[model samples]
Target: MAGRLLLIWRLLVRDLRRHRTETLLLLLAITAATATLTLGLTLHELVARPYEQTRAATAGPDLVVQAGQPGPHSLDALAPLTTLPGVTNHSGPYPLAFLALTAGDTTARVVVEGRDGTPAAVDRPAVTDGTWIRPGGVVVERTFADALGVHVGDTVSVAGHPLGVTGFAVTAARPAYPRAGWHLPGSILTEGGGLVWVERGDIATLAGEQPLSYTVNLRLADPQAGAAVIDPSGGDARFRGWRFSTGQEIADTNGRLNAPAQQALMIGSWLLTALAVVGVAGIVAGRAIGQRRRVGLLKAVGAGPAMIAAVHLAEYLVIALAAAGTGLAVGWLAAPPLFRPTAGLLGSVGMHPPPLRMVAAATALALTIAVAATLAPVLRAAATDTTHALADAAVPPRRRRWVISLSRRLPIALLIGVRINARRPRRAWLVTVNTLITTTALAAALMALAQERSPVDLGYSKLPDARDERTTQAMILVVCVVCFLALLNTVVSTWTAVLSTRHPLAVTRVLGATPAQAGVGLAVAQLLPAIPGVAAGLLLGILTFFAGDDNQHAPASWMLTAGLGVPLAVVALTAIPAVAAARRPVADTLQAGVR
Candidate 1:
């Protein structure tokens, strides 16, 4: 057992050093998968951690009740809330008013909160830079201030009042600038806007007859009980058009600020993983085919099937281990930016590594893909016959009666192309399946972007913000990454096919076939399977991502174009490398086996 292990180890090490490019390809494929998985798994925590930190730093409220109409009467409406059964403590009747702030060339819609210099028990915003609300100074939310490039001592005109930006602060009571509040309950009442903290006496200057909402922050014994604790029927002096939100709901809403975008990214990661599987499998098969002579020689030397298989499998195992570590590091670093869109609400998005469970799962998943991809090819190599391995002759092309009879009437290039595909039907099918998976992901991403772009009549006015744009960007990023890897896979597969058929192609050139025909033949082999693959991908994409969203409409024309275009595009991409390989001197190619 020790002797056999030593043999396998030596063989694996020698082959890895010799086939450096192939080894690197294997490493990159798995690394991409693991990195994507790590990012997807840690996305929630990426947002959750910052939220918790900010919530802890500032005594964020459990519930917020806002009266739509402003005045002393509005304050009176919320005074009865302290007597509620579950209410423990409360803050406000703070004055909330929406007004525009202008600084130089920039004009920002901002929600100004009137606060006293005294600190409160609930929703106490922690000062990040400079001091809290002072007599003649205004404090800006950290993210909002960062966006406008406003610093301490900078003056900004708020409702035509030039207030000094005395400080920067962060709070858990409200979302950062541009996502003032949630969309469902009181979206209009609190339209997306930046937040500002000002002295209570400054409220009149900013208000200037502009509408105001009197907001009260409530701390309940049971934060989860929420609006249910409030008896609407009972004459508790409830204000007309009052909106109430629970602490738990606020936390969840804050946590999921970028939920749609994160979900899209996670879905994209899984798609990339699928592509990695197909790509790795194709690469392994190519490697096995290329090393057929080596496999036969091993068998002739009296190596057992199990021993030979281990040598081949061990190469990927070593690479997989290295790739898992690289991928984990890359993903850990890449995840912080993904949560930046919600950084305003969360305060400081920390670079916390993905949980250990997630890392383990990602590593396991990558290793599984590596093993699965190589299994079939390794088995084929192990099962090679000693006599055939020593001889190293190419497989005889199967005679096709229909093809031969019909080819006389067709162009030489097209006929040759058709013949090449017929010779290796299985390989052609595998390439086709890969194309299908790639195009399906592309189609789904496009569909998602289309949905995000199209206007949805949700029976209310929607706030203009970065949330939708961020989601679209996430989908686009995924599409780009997937397409790039798929492109690389296509090139590699084409090059491998060219290498395998070099002898046969050289013989054909000697029999009056031109370089162009050989190249076309090579491209044709990949394109034939692509037709059905593209069609299947389109259908699958529509069924998978387009079915659930009622607000989205399908772009039948675009899907059709994509299905047709992708196969032709593959042919174009494959042609250059195919032609280059075909143009190699026939003598040198024929003598390659002898060397």
Candidate 2:
């Protein structure tokens, strides 16, 4: 006569212990979500801090001015801006060039920040690799060295002039156009980053030829120096203008400039969040199904619906909280790279830890997504009639006359598919939604790549060198990989769900349906819902381009491939798993599903 609440708690705890695999998966899901949010919030800070420290110790300037023509006028033009009300100090008239350099067996690119002085602290590069740039030597960006697998003592040639990499150093400046965007600049641009520090006297000889291509850099005394100049056009005409950067400004700017990388961070965050939703919910639903029959016995004993719902929902709450906390802790440790961009960018403006609000927001978002995704299945179980729920071992659908009639008239596989789909509409919807997310992500990534390579609004290609192109391409490859994995997981999850209906499937197999017929039936069950899902996903991929983006137009080939390819790939992936699962003995399957 005692209440079932205690029984429910005991049962829930027992299930948690018994399902170690499910619990681990739940932990992984939450961990990924937590890591992504933490990374998104903290990347700039992590990347920018060391650079800021280096910048402060050295005389790194605040603003960089680049000109199409390196001439006296460029220098003359900067003279007045330094005299602006808030403007204080200045550093260059430094000549910078981005060139593809070949060093022995390795062919790569180097960014040359040609200066007229020794490496300093206020505006200097701290020589970490070797000595500072002497009359004949150059300093390399440490990351660039890490990429090329070169060392401080190695030699790198730019435009035929081979110079020893005197030292590996960190600077206080970085361009959005090159590598080091906290945004995942893909692998190519992200790699091969080099800075050749040429002596003031050797500029002409090192450059191959230079009247000095036009560039002026300024170092502002205050943080607010060129704040108003972000818009670009409103500044003085003769000055074509230089943009001033602060340590914090560097981090924020890096985020904005690296579109693909930032998108990656954002997508990764949302993706993990979505996966956690599906993963946690699946485990919840599976448990709820088991609990449903027992709850029916309780309902017959006059147990209240509210109590039933609370008991089931409470188990999820505990799991979710544990997941959230564990995930946050993992993210806290794993996400420093995401918060700060590249070293140089960070040093231009100091990086700071985000306020407590970001952490609070991350927790809230994870909880909401997890709780909402699980509630539907739990609520459905709670609402079912006690007798109907308890009597059937494998619950039948309410009604699917349309599916039954169409199946009766169709090919064996098609008919089987239609019926299977109708039997479990939720699974079908899940497959469609998962497919949509992958395709949309791929589409968005492809479009991002196109933007980086072309940057239409700015006309000139974002990077004019092979190294830059390579970095962007690397990012695309990751997009492709991520999409493939998400799609693959969906196929696996679908197969697992289908195996839960072995009894019904066994009946079909026993009804003179050949093994091939049974297989087709299984395939159809997956494909019927997939057709719409793929079509819709393709539409979403295209629409996403025109959505909030620059109204960019993609070649039809990309759209078709992304849209159609995703669904087909998913369907194809399911084939092997479905076949393997379906091939098991009909008797065993029937017995298990009924149990």
Candidate 3:
């Protein structure tokens, strides 16, 4: 068995060396797939730690209770419940007041939790950049600090109070929400509204001297017991209740109150990974014909079909390992940054290395892609007889021959491109599938951009200052990336297609067609089948929105235009590469193809 394996390795290495291009592509693909998985899975554990720590420290409450209307006692009543079965220690029938703050023309609504005077309490927030809250000073969540461009000692006004910014900190308490990669939730902070720490006397007067409301934070005897308390409370606010969130949920949500961004990023990773797998599969199958002569030769020798297949498959496995390894590293590095844009939303101000599980999962995905893409062709090569495989060189009959015959009287360029493309329908199909995958990726990216639900200050939606800028940034990123990939794929596809079909194009030239005409003909062929593909992709995208949100199904004119324009753009973009490849010295290309 060892000797057989060695022999297969030798054969695979030799073939892999011969097909360096495909081997390189396999490496690139594995790297991409691995990177995406690692980033998606590990983001919370690695990148979201600061936010988690901040959330835990500030909230110190096991269940934060609130009142529907303003009354201080609704919070005080929770004291007896803590004395109930699972509960033990508790703090703060503390005042949590929400207020709208105005700093010059900029305004923000802030969620404020009254802090206990002591620094070392169980739910205490640790100071990060400056002194803790003094009688007249407040501490702001570090993430929010970074956003509001405020620091310790920088003063801002909230609800007409001139507050002293005494500190920047992370608390298990009040801070900005966490956001997924798809969006950012804008945040505003101050001394409890700039770090305005009012000695107890000023609290009610500053809060509009407003009607008072309060809530308590309890620390359970067993932290897990807190969840049991939370579940039963969901149905009614009559006991007027509290919902308990787990460490992980809190960590996840630490990035945002509603983690739409994280969910979007995860889905985006999965969707792109699927498209990459499909594209690679098409490319692998397209290369199978090119390997036929080699397959036949190996079979003709005493080598069994199994060894031949093993050799082909093993080549991919070797590359997959390297690619997966590389991709995992890239994912680890990228994950931290991916979360950077939304860090303020999470309330975290620290960075953590990704957990081991995220790296392992990503590597597995990369190998899966390589195996899934290459398995069929490798197996097919092994299953064939030597003579039959070797003798499989009969001229591929012209596809849709009758149709081409009928169109022969048409313009030279269209006739030639159609005839050649028809002869190798599978290659045309490979190109088409590649195009579709590109379209799918572009669409997913655009959707991510368009659907961003980043957080903003509550009730500030109608405010002049509130802007969903992240969504705009995401849109520009998606468009730029899609355009670049579209241009890149168009050129490469045309060049590869033209090179693969050069013999036919050369023959057309021999039969009396201009080189320019032949080149244009190649573009025509790609454009024809691509029409339906682009249209279908557009319809799918539009339907996706409708399916995802029945209300969003309103007819969109731009989608239709983009869908129609993609194929036309593909054809136009392809012309330069096709023309360049076509103008290559015909005799030289024919000689190369012959060899």
Q: Against the true structure, whose lDDT is highest?
A: 1
Alpha-carbon local distance difference test for all models: 0.76, 0.59, 0.58
Can you write out model 1's per-residue Cα lDDT over 271-343, one digit (the tens) per residue? 7787777778778867876687888888878898998888888888889888888888877777677546544
Which residue runs of candidate 1 sit more than 4 Å off their true CA positions? Answer: 62-110, 118-122, 128-131, 142-162, 177-179, 182-193, 208-247, 297-304, 346-350, 397-400, 407-409, 441-463, 534-569, 591-595
Ranking by lDDT: 1, 2, 3
Please provide, for model 2 over 59-147, each residue's C-alpha lDDT reduced to its tens digit, 9 standing for 90 to 100. 66666545434555556655555566655665566765555556556555555667765543236666665778877677766655554
What TM-score, over all chains together, does every model reach? 0.81, 0.69, 0.79
Backbone collision tally, model 2: 44
Candidate 2 TM-score, C-alpha based:
0.69
- Full candidate order by TM-score, most accurate first: 1, 3, 2
What residue runs in model 3 are displaced by over 4 Å at the alpha carbon?
Answer: 14-20, 37-39, 42-61, 65-93, 143-151, 174-205, 227-258, 285-290, 341-357, 388-395, 398-401, 440-457, 460-492, 547-565, 589-595
Q: Write the per-residue lDDT of candidate 3 for residues 1-595, one digit (tens) a residue.
A: 8988898878777878787775665566556656656655554554365555454555454544443345665655655665666666566566555665444445555544566567533456666678866665666666555546676777766567777878766545333332211111112222222222333544565577656555456666676665566345556655433333344454544444324444544554564465456556655664675777778887776778677877777877777788777877776665445445444433322244456676567667777887887787788778876776787543556567587667779888888667766776765665566556555555544554455344543344222111234333333433443454344445545645664677777877888888899889988877866766675666565455444542333235545556666787887888877788778777986776631
What's the CA RMSD of model 2 in angstroms? 7.5
Q: After best superposition, candidate 2 residue 74: deviation in angstroms?
A: 12
Q: Once model 3 is optimally superposed onto the true structure by TM-score, how far is the C-alpha of residue 517 displaced, in angstroms?
A: 2.5
Give the worst 10-residue stretch by lDDT in candidate 2. Answer: 181-190
- For model 2, the stretches where C-alpha displacement exceeds 4 angstroms are 1-12, 25-43, 46-53, 56-121, 140-164, 173-222, 225-255, 268-283, 297-307, 314-358, 385-396, 443-500, 509-516, 546-595
